[model samples]
Target: MTKEITIDDLKMYRALVETGSVLGKNTVLNIISHAGEAAETILRKQNAIDTLDRIITQQCQAALDATGLHHLIDEDGDGDWSAVWEGLQELADQKRHAERNADTYQKLYEQRAESLEQAERERDEWRGKYDESETARIFGEAQQERVRALHSPEPARYYGTDLNPNRQHDCAGCGEGWAWPCGTIRALDGDPNAAV
Candidate 1:
């Protein structure tokens, strides 16, 4: 049958064995052996408990340090977890406010970038229209000069039959001895076969 034995009982058995008591030799040896075994078991259990307690303390300290809440640790070097909870709540509030500000700044940045891009596009469009209008204005002036040249009056020239019979009807404008219609006039009139 199994029975509980205390440290006191084990110590008493060990003392009796050491004192050479009247108990039978085999019985004293058995009690001494059982006492040693019980002491070893108790020591092992106490070591395990100490190790577990140290691990728990270290974990609590690490938690406090990681959360920036080390101030919440009590005077005895134990964590006041409820105070840490309050500190965490304040940290969470600050984080939420920072995130909201970041989101608002991000939105403003996007809007500003979009507005800049739109302004650039509009500026480019206006530049293109201005370039087209300037080109058209230059082309119209050139066309007007061409039309004025075609209709300009030429100075009259007289060629006597005896002095210059072959050039009797020369064009006074270009000095070309052609008929009434000259090459310059014919070319301006859209005649493909006319010489420029």
Candidate 2:
């Protein structure tokens, strides 16, 4: 272990620099600067040493083995706790990766569900529009049938006990027969088969 520099060392160095003559002040100041650098290096090394000591102490206190040595080292008697710590870190990383994958899959499922729902809604809307158009088309055809029925003339009819005079005139309305208009023409007219 290296010796720890103290505030007393700094005080002594300062006193030496102040008591030095004007010509030696520069040399003393240079020496003090070098000492400061050395102190900084020592402080860094001490910090590292303190950190390692704390880790070793904690590892020994929390040792899994009854001997308090197997958990801290390997079978070859070397300082190799890297495998255990690395394995633990890998497990933690894997857990985080799985969680991230699960979250991504859940979001994808939600998005697909929303898309399917939207498609179903659009299909239903289109079906409704088609049904309405079909109904309108049927209604329009019914209206046309009603108009035709109202405009077309009905076939003329006569009740019993009142003989129909125009019964012999099958083609009465349209004078296409030879004895048409008044049924006065004989069968030997220009059209011989007029009565049949």
Candidate 3:
């Protein structure tokens, strides 16, 4: 017998295609969800930083008023707003520079101290919650893989599948084709065993 195709083969191919589509969709959703959560965390920290800036501004204003600099640079015949603004700007710039140039060891010590302080504030319970969540995520991923493996249709017996990406096969199925790959098979021309 030269070659022949059958209906059973087509059914197998269709099942494999369907399974791959499901896996791709689910994996994409998982990645997008993770990214969204991380983005929210970053935004929360950014908002805190903005609040800190506002507090610093108010404090600077109060300092200027109390030091009589506001009166000395008074242009509105009320307060020296321009000089106050300039001097405050200079002070803010210096503070930012100092923060950037902070000694690594000193900064590390401060960071550890702050983290320790926070941990204490939470009574060590916050880390426990984090540990539980991490454990859950790890197991959830394992369960997902198990479900996919158990549910995803096995590769087409005769040739390849979506999971076996490099398997030799035709991209487009022929009209009632069979075992031997036919019609625009990518691997046919490029395959190592094919005519060189």
Candidate 4:
């Protein structure tokens, strides 16, 4: 029967049988060969994996046969988690908006700690350059440089017509986060339509 069925019909049938969705019409007809019990196991496992977290996915993949959850966890009916698209999009938007406009106290704390480390190093440099008393006096004379250098503004920055301050740097806000943007870390995201 499949031999007579067109590729489009096959893909549609696959999508319907595999995910019960009409998505990924592009690959609907690519599963004429999978129109059997073997396809059921593969599609079932694929759904299971898609619904799982990374640790669970790995553990399940390790223990469960490939025909099981492999298709689900990393499946993309049309190359995406068509089943959880809305949930995923909502999470992304939440993170993005939260990162940009919410209480970034946690992120700012990290930046502060980093700045403190830099400041400590700079203070050490000053101490090496001069006696502790002299270093203290110099820093007390102008705390702005010490503050900027330690807190951030390390790589480089130009606040005003102030030609340059020996060690200015790009601002943290330049890269999204005032210190560490979320992309600094990437959470796992799987797509089934990707190449093997």
Candidate 5:
């Protein structure tokens, strides 16, 4: 077994043949020298192209690996553009899948928000109805008392006031009527002499 000669070795041999003066056969020496020079030039150019190809392949492989598409590399391990294209296609598909999922989630979020808003609106309406019913119950009780007083021989007139036992002062501003403490505060504030 022998080690193969490289372009640099051939070039060094050619230089020695050209510079050496010990050669007796000028013609034979010229022939060998020219052949060596030609081989060296061709081999050098070819080696340069091979090195460039290896660099490009490394760069391409690095890029593909970053995208997590190393499996797309061909069986021969060559730098084939078709393999790179396949990796790119996989990336595009992944991007599209993510976009679709985002759109679906956005729609779901919007639907949930609308549902929550509707529920809140309904709850507010029910609360308002409950408040109205309670107000009506209070007014109905006051009206019943007024009616009972009118029927009694010894009648006690209805005084406008809240039903709290602690506050015995009736609202003189509202007089004898079923009235909320609406104007009483303002009326009391206006009259300095009046008790709140």
Candidate 6:
């Protein structure tokens, strides 16, 4: 195909035409040679660009064919890049949702662990109080038993003749002779009116 002249090429041509009559023959020839060289460079650059574009297109098409992703291309052979962009956005959204759920579960786990620890501490405190009360109860019973043993009654003794006998019972701890039920024994048996 024939190449169209650009504005820059037209301007160069106009400058050459205007200077051709005043310039020497060698100068005119040199100007034309330089113009030709500039045009050749532009053509070479355009050819290289075209070759690179073709190579890239061929490689992209080959990759799509191998991956079986030809549906991502439109009927005009252009890639539907918006579809890929939307898919990436969806994945990012899912990742954000998963991270939020993980944070919620982690908070719940920490709260549960803290609650369990609190319950265990309370249980230990209650157990300690129960042990103290039980020990007090056992010590109180032992002291009560010791008091009962000290104040126990013995057999009655008579210190007179058979006609007029004075009978009295002896205390086991103090060996004192008194009435049948002693004051100390009555007090140990929880009598409120017992005298000591």
lDDT, candidate 3, equals 0.60
lDDT of 3 by residue, 94-171 (tens): 888887777766889899999999879797688889999999999987875654333322234335556444544322
Candidate 6 regions exceeding 4 Å error are 1-92, 159-170, 174-176, 179-181
Best by TM-score: 6
* Clash counts for all predictions: 0, 0, 4, 21, 0, 0
Model 6: residue 74 alpha-carbon error in angstroms: 16
> On lDDT, who's better, 1 or 2?
1
lDDT at residue 16 of model 4 (Cα atoms): 84
Q: Which stretches of candidate 2 lie over 4 Å from their true place?
A: 1-37, 47-87, 96-136, 148-158, 164-196
Candidate 3 positional error at 5, Å: 45
Ranking by lDDT: 6, 1, 5, 2, 3, 4
Q: At residue 166, what lDDT does model 1 achieve?
A: 47
Top candidate, metric lDDT: 6
Quote the lDDT for 178 in model 5. 21
lDDT for residue 36 in candidate 1, whole number 0-100: 78
Q: Candidate 2 vs candidate 3: which has greater TM-score?
A: 2
The weakest ten consecutive residues by lDDT in model 6 span: 159-168
Model 2, clash count?
A: 0
Model 1 ranges with Cα > 4 A deviation: 1-63, 66-76, 79-81, 141-196
TM-score of each: 0.41, 0.35, 0.26, 0.17, 0.36, 0.44
Q: Which TM-score value belongs to model 6?
A: 0.44
lDDT on C-alpha atoms for all candidate structures: 0.74, 0.63, 0.60, 0.53, 0.66, 0.75
Q: For model 5, what is the C-alpha lDDT against the true structure?
A: 0.66
lDDT of 4 at 63: 35
TM-score of 4: 0.17
What lDDT tens digits, residue by residue, belong to model 2 across residues 35-57? 88997899999999999989986
Worst 10 residues of 2 by lDDT: 178-187
